[model samples]
Target chain A: EAGVVQSPRYKIIEKKQPVAFWCNPISGHNTLYWYLQNLGQGPELLIRYENEEAVDDSQLPKDRFSAERLKGVDSTLKIQPAELGDSAVYLCASSRTVYNEQFFGPGTRLTVL
Target chain B: SQQGEEDPQALSIQEGENATMNCSYKTSINNLQWYRQNSGRGLVHLILIRSNEREKHSGRLRVTLDTSKKSSSLLITASRAADTASYFCATDSGATNKLIFGTGTLLAVQP
Candidate 1:
């Protein structure tokens, strides 16, 4: 089976611009997650969706970051007015359930100048 | 905030040698997992050990979990150059099942 897929493997934008990243989860997976990984640091969870409902998003920066999984199979994470500090790798992962092993996508590397 | 911290920010080893990495985390966890990420790539799950489990092995990878100490260790025997990557330890804690990842250890295996 194919693994999770993400679009625009790399993106570059100027500060204050809007940027969006898209993800497609593995087939039959019910849980999807978005994470942010900075240089020399591990990934940090930004949001999680169980089916179409976002079960955990406490770590997400609501003021500038928003995410949605309308069909429960695909998800999109958007950052409005991106800042210089917003430059990092955005990873998407999916699993059959919350307790199952997660499969990750290649991730989108965003650079904000 | 990151919950886990890995020992040795970086390591260099020769092929056929053994590589070990340690991870220490705060708070209780249901399970701990190890993942490997190649340069500019996504993470790949390496192994997982439950809180109650002491040791588990998969091929050349061995993982040990000590809940009492809130720590875990990963051992890769007969390491190969292909093993050169960044390794991260993540803890599954609370009802949310959120994985709190460590800072990660970058391992370079010389061919």
Candidate 2:
């Protein structure tokens, strides 16, 4: 079985620009999550989706960050007017159930100049 | 937000030595899980100890959870160079089943 997959392993854009990252969860995985990892820090949850509905998103910065999971399979996270602080690794993970361990993707490393 | 903090932020050991990492977390949790991450890569699940379970083992790794102390420890016996990586502890406490991770312990095993 395939693990969670993320696209554009690396991205670089100027501040105030828009950037997007895509994720494809493993087949049969019902829960999907997006996380941000800064240097020397652990990954922080950004948004989580149970099937097609977002069940947790309080940590997301709605001012510029937006996320969507269409059809409960793949997900997309976008940052409009990216800020320098947004420069970090965006990781995607999925699990068969909420109680199970999550499988992570290679992550999309973004650099906002 | 981070829920746990791993002690000995960095450690170095010989290839055949045992390595131990400690994690302390705040609040009540349903489970505590360990994960390993190599440089520039995704995380790999190592082990999980439920709140009800005090100890668990897998291969050369052992994890002990002390709910009363809100602390956990991961011990890798006879670790090899391949074991060189960062280890993190994540806590599951919310109804959403989300995990709150710790900063992690960076271990280097010299061959």
Score chain A of model 1 by TM-score against the reference chain A.
Answer: 0.99
Q: Comparing to the true complex, what docking class would candidate 1 get?
A: high
Maximum-TM-score candidate? 1
Candidate 1 structure quality by residue, lDDT tens digits, B1-111: 898999989999999999999999999999999999996567999999998899999999999999989999999999999999999999998567999999999999999
Query: Which candidate tops DockQ?
Result: 1
Q: In every candidate, what fraction of the native interface contacts is reproduced?
A: 0.83, 0.89
Q: After superposition, how far is residue B77 of candidate 1 from its true place, in Å?
A: 0.1
Q: Which ten residues in a row have the lowest lDDT in candidate 2 chain B?
A: B39-48
Q: Residue-wise lDDT of candidate 2 within B35-84, one digit each (tens)?
A: 99996667999898999999999999999999999999999999999999
Worst 10 residues of 1 chain B by lDDT: B39-48
Assess each prediction's global lDDT (C-alpha) against the native.
0.95, 0.94
Query: Which runs of model 2 end up more than 4 angstroms from their true locations?
Result: none
lDDT of 1 by residue, A26-61 (tens): 999999999999999999999999999999999999
Off by over 4 Å in 1: none
